[model samples]
Structure formats: structure tokens, C-alpha cells
Target: MEKKLNHLLADLVVEYHKLQSFHWYLKGYHFFDDHAKLEEYYDAIAEAVDTVAEDMLMLGFKPESTMKGFLSISSIEEAKNQEVTSVEAYEAVLADFKYLLDEVKGVKAAADESGDYLTSTKMDDYIEFFSKAIWMVGQEVR
Candidate 1:
């Protein structure tokens, strides 16, 4: 459970940074729309980052709060400095979310198996949000 939570926290942190990068570096026809939406996404990810860390603290485990720690453990890849189209960025976001969604589902399952309902419930919320985000972002991926 600790390992799962820590990995989730790290992925959230890395994904937040990637979203920021996309928000900053994105250009082309969808710039205005994608920029604003990426900002919104990153904001939500930022909140999730804090929430996961707090939950870890509540569970009496120290969260991995450093960039180094996050990069080391996160499965999500960091955004590159190269230029990319809005579609490409959106696709990248969708892919990351899909991957994270599966990971979160696993976390929730483990939490339930461990009888940690609080964490399980929290993961449910994350699952819902990610599912919606995946749908919305998928619309723009092509």
C-alpha cells in the first residue's frame, strides 16, 4: 500500500509538471483552447498531489515530495523541450492519463483488499476524474 501510494504521488507530481510544460509549450491552431484546458488539468493535478501527500502523512508514511524523488519513481515520462502540435500534446496527455487510470485502479483494489476504505474511496474519486478527463481529452487526440 505504501509503495502504491508513493508511486501514485510521484506520478501525480510528474504529470503535473508535464501538464505545465504542455500548457507552456503548446502551439498551433488549438493553442488558446489547449492552453487553458492544460492549465485546468494541471491545477487539478496539483491538488491531487497535495491530497495524496496529506493522505500519506495521515497514514503515518512520509510522502516523496521532491522532484528527484518523483522523477525516480514516476512511470510517466517528462515532457520534452521539442516543439509539438496540439494534437500531439493532447495525445500524450491522454496516454498518460490512461496509464495512470489503470495504476489508480490497481491502487484502489489493493486498498480495498487491505481494508483501507479511506484510501479506496479517495482512489474512486480519482478514477472518476481520470475517466472523464480521458473522455474529454480523447476527443481532441486525433
Candidate 2:
């Protein structure tokens, strides 16, 4: 459970940076909407990052806090370039959301198996958020 939580934390951190990169450098039509959406994404990811780290602490595990630590464990790759089109940004965001959803589901399952109801229930919010994000961003990408 701790390991899953740590991986989730790493993903959240990398995803946060990706959102920031998109929010800052995306261009062309839909820039306003995409920028605002990316801002919302990063904001939510920031909250998740903090929550996951605290959750780890509560479970008597140390959360990985450094960028190097996050990069090492996170499956999500960093933004390839600072600038990206709205389509490219949306595609990347959609993919990350899907990946994180799966990761969270796995974490929830592990927590349930371990009888850690607190951690299991905690993942519910993340599951819902990522599902909604995938739908919303899917529309944009499509």
C-alpha cells in the first residue's frame, strides 16, 4: 500500500508539472480555454500531491518529495517541450488522466486487500476526479 501510494504521489507530481508546462506554453486557438483548464488541472493535482504525502505520513511511510525522486518512480514522462498545441496538450493530459485513474484503482484495490479502509476510501475522490477529467478532456481531444 505504501509503495502504491508513493508511486501515486510521484505520478501526481509529474502530472502537476506537465499541466504547468501546458498552461504556460500552449498556443493557437482555444488557448484561453486550454490555459484555464490546465490551471484547474495543476491546482487539483497540487491538492492531491499534498493529500497523498500526508496520507503516507499517517500510514507511517515517508512520501517521496524531491523532483528526482518523483521522476525516478513516476511512469508519466515529463513534457517533451515547453511549447505545445492545444491538441497536443489535451492528448497528453487525457493520457495522463487515464494512467492515473488506473494507478488509483490499483491503489484502492491494494488498500482494500490490506484492510486499509481509510486509504481505500481516500482513493474514491481521485477516481471520480480522474474519470471526470478523462471525459471532459476526451471531448477536447476528439
Candidate 3:
């Protein structure tokens, strides 16, 4: 795998964990509903992370799954046990998704730069899906 792809994959793992933390820690009047939705989003991101790792393995590169590796590569904020309101949680998720949109786009760009059309296409699809999901979250916040 290209170095850029490795960086992006590591970021995906970190962001995946952050999303999961949000799902687990999320609270408010809409706790049940919002939690469920967050779980769905987090699960999808976890699957995408797996796909990215597999791609790295297929390219003869070792996948980075360690916390240290994620910390080193991710631009996304780490998950913390901060108390947040429903609106805050919604906004945080929206922000995270927006960040993910950029990261996935960067992954796609790296793939293209490395002449890996397949990876580029896959990342592009993920970017589109996450972007729409972020928009949905934004609507919910409004």
C-alpha cells in the first residue's frame, strides 16, 4: 500500500473508534433514537475500515490497527468522556462526518496518485455515502 493510503486507513480506524464512543456515550431526551442511529453509522464505518485494511493487506502492506498508529495518523479528535447535550451530540456527529468526508476524499486522491483505480473508486463511494449521511445528521440537528 502507498504511504498515503496507510495514513488514511489509520485515520479511518481512529475515526471509527470515535464514532463508536459517541454512540456509547450519547445521551439526551432522544437518547434511544439517536443512539440507534449512531450505532448504525459506526457499524458502517467499522466495515469500511475493515475494507481499507484488507486493501492494504492485498497490496502487501501490513495493516495498522494499533491505538498508537491511529493516534499518530488521525486528524480526527480522540474520543473522550465528555458530557454533551442532544444538540451537542448531533453537532459533534455532523462535524465528525464532515471530517470523514475530507479524509475519504484524501484517500481517494492518494489511490489515484498511486494508480490504484480500484481503491480510488471504493473510497469515492464511501465519501459519497458519508457525505449524505452527514447531511442527514445536519437536518436532524436543524
Candidate 4:
């Protein structure tokens, strides 16, 4: 149970970092609008990361915060470049959101396998959020 929670928290850290990268590096004419929206979105994801890490700790698991830890546990790819155009950024985030939905689904499965109802519930909520965000982002692609 503790291990599963720790793994899920580690995945959250990776997603948080990607969102922050998107927020910082997004560019193009829609800069002001997209930048502000990305910041708001990333902030929410960061909060979720913190909450999940804290919950892991509460469950007596040491939450991993290092990049190495995230890389090891997360299926999501880290952002490789910061020079992406607005369209590229939007596409990248849409891809990340899809990846996140899959990761959250896996987390929920792990939680259920481990008999961790709370973690499973949280994963379900996150999956729903990411699924909706993916759909919204998809509409922005050209």
C-alpha cells in the first residue's frame, strides 16, 4: 500500500514539472492568454502533487521528490525543449494530459490491488480532471 502510494506521488511530481515547463515556455501571439491559463492549470497540478505527497507521508511512505525518482516511476516524458511554439506547446500538453490519464488509471488499479480505497478514489478524480482537460486542449489544436 505504502509503495503504491509512493509510486503514485512520484508520478504526480513528474506531471507537475511538465505542467510548469509548459507554463514557462509557452509562446506565440496567444502568449498572454495561454500563459496565464497555463499558470493557473500548472498551479492546480502542483497543489495536487503536494497533496498526494503529503498523503503518502501520512500513510508512512516517504514521498519521493527527486527527478530521478519521478523518472523511475512516471511513464510520462519530461519536456525536452523550451522553444516550442504555442501550437507545439498546446499539442505537447494535450499529449501529456492523455499520458496522465493513463497513469492515473494505473494508479487507481494499483490502489485497488493494494486495498487502498482513498488513493483509488483520488486517482479516479484526477483521471476525470485530466480527461476533461485533454478534451479542452484538443479543441485548441489547429
Candidate 5:
């Protein structure tokens, strides 16, 4: 369970940075609005990353905190030199948000199996937040 949580933390850290890239690189229609939206997403992801790390600490597990570490464990891929429009950015973010929710759900199940209600409850908050984010981003892309 600890390893799973650490893997999630790493992936989220990667996602948070990916949101930064999305904010920096997104162009085209709805630039300002999209930029602002990316900001909100990144900020929320940052908070979540911190929360995940703290949870790791609470469990006496050292959270992986490096790009190499994140890259190894993250199911989500980092954007390289790809240039994409705001629409593409939204699409990518929406997809990632969905992926993240899936991971959180899996983690919640593991937490339940281990009788870790605290972690499971944390995942509940994550599911709620990301589910809303997924809906909003989907609307943005469509």
C-alpha cells in the first residue's frame, strides 16, 4: 500500500508539472481563459501532491520527490517538445484527470483492503475533486 501511495504521489507530482507545461505552452482560442484554467488545475494538483507526501510521511514512507523517480512510477507521460493548442491541452489534461481518478480509486480499494480508512477517505476527496475537474475540462474541450 505504501508503494502504491508513493507511486501515486510521484505521478501526481509529474502531473502537477505537466499542468505547468500546459499553462506555458497552450495557445490559440481561449488563451487567457485556458491559461487561467491551467493555473487553477496546477494549483490544486500542487496541494494534492503535498497532501499525498504528508500522508506518506504519516505512514513513515519516504515520498519519492524527483523527476527521475516520478518518471519511473508515473502512468502518465510527460509532454516533451510537443506544441499543442488550448483544445489539445484541455484534452490531454482531461484524459490525465480521468487516469488520475482511476488510480485514486484503485488506491482507495487497497486502503480499504488494509483497513486504512483515513487513506480511503483521502482518496474520496480526490475522486470528488478530479471527477468535477474531468467534467469541467470535458466541457471546455467540447
Candidate 6:
């Protein structure tokens, strides 16, 4: 359970960077709007990273803080230097949100198995946020 949360935290860190990259590099019809949205997303991801890492600490686990650690554990890969359209960025984020939502469900199940209601609740909050993010990003792409 701790391991899963730590992996999710690493993914959150990577997701924050990816969102920042998109916020800075995305170009197209809605450049300003998409840029602002990605900024908001990256900020939210940063908060999630902090929250999850703290939760891992509470569970007596050290969170992965280095880029190498993150890259090794995270399922989402960073796309640095590649030119991406706003639609493509949104689609990528939506896919990431979908992936996170799926992982969180399994984490929640693990938490339940361990009788860790607090962790399950935390994952519940993240799951809800990711579901909404997926919907919003999916809309932008569509």
C-alpha cells in the first residue's frame, strides 16, 4: 500500500513537470486559454505530490523525490522538447488522468484490504479530481 502511494506520488511529480512543459510549449488556436489551464493543472499536481508524499511519510515510507526515482516508478513518460499542439497536449493529459484514476482505484482497494480508511479517503479525493480532470481535458480535445 505504501509502495503504491509512493509510486503515485512520483507520478504526480512527473505529471506536474509534464503539465508545466505543456503550459509553456503548447501552441494553437487557444494558446492563452490552454496555457492558463495547464498552469492550473500543474499547480494542482504539485499539491497532490506534496499531499501524497506526506501521506507516505505518515505510513512510515520515504517518498521518491529524485527525477531518476520518479522516472523509474512513474507510468507516465515526460515529453520534453517535442512540439505539441494544444489538442495533443489536452489529449495527453486526459490520457494521464485516465491512467491515474485507474491506478487510484487499485490503491483504494489495497488501502481497504489493509484497513486504512484514511489512505482510502485520500485516494478517493484524488480519484474524484482525476475523473473531473479527465472529463474537462477530454472535452478540450474533443
Report the number of clashing residue pairs per model: 0, 0, 0, 0, 0, 0
Candidate 6 lDDT, tens digit per residue, 67-135?
A: 999999899989787767998898889888999999989999999999988889999998899999888
Question: Cα RMSD (Å) between model 2 and the true structure?
Answer: 0.8
Kindly report the root-mean-square deviation of model 3 from the true structure over all alpha carbons: 1.7
Question: What residue runs in model 4 are displaced by over 4 Å at the alpha carbon?
Answer: 1-3
lDDT of all predictions: 0.92, 0.92, 0.79, 0.78, 0.89, 0.87
Model 6 residue runs over 4 Å out of place are none
- Reference-based lDDT, residue 32, model 2: 89
> How close is every model to the real structure, measured as TM-score?
0.97, 0.97, 0.89, 0.85, 0.95, 0.95
Clashing pairs in 5: none
Model 3 stretches astray by more than 4 angstroms: none
Task: Give per-residue CA lDDT, model 4, range 5-105, as digits (tens).
Answer: 66666666776777678778777899898888777777878888888887787667788878887788776678765666678878878887787788778
Error in Å for residue 46 of model 4: 0.5
What TM-score does model 3 achieve against the real structure? 0.89
- Predicted structure 5: clash tally: 0
RMSD of 5: 1.1
lDDT by residue (tens digit), candidate 2, 80-101:
7668999999999998899999
Tens digits of lDDT, candidate 3, 87-110: 877787788788778877887887
Off by over 4 Å in 1: none
**Between which residue pairs do clashes occur in model 2?**
none
Tens-place lDDT digits, model 1, residues 67-142: 8988999999999987778898888999999999999999999999999888999999999999999999988865
Q: How accurate is candidate 6 locally (lDDT)?
A: 0.87
Candidate 1, run of 10 with poorest lDDT: 81-90
lDDT score of residue 75 within candidate 3: 74
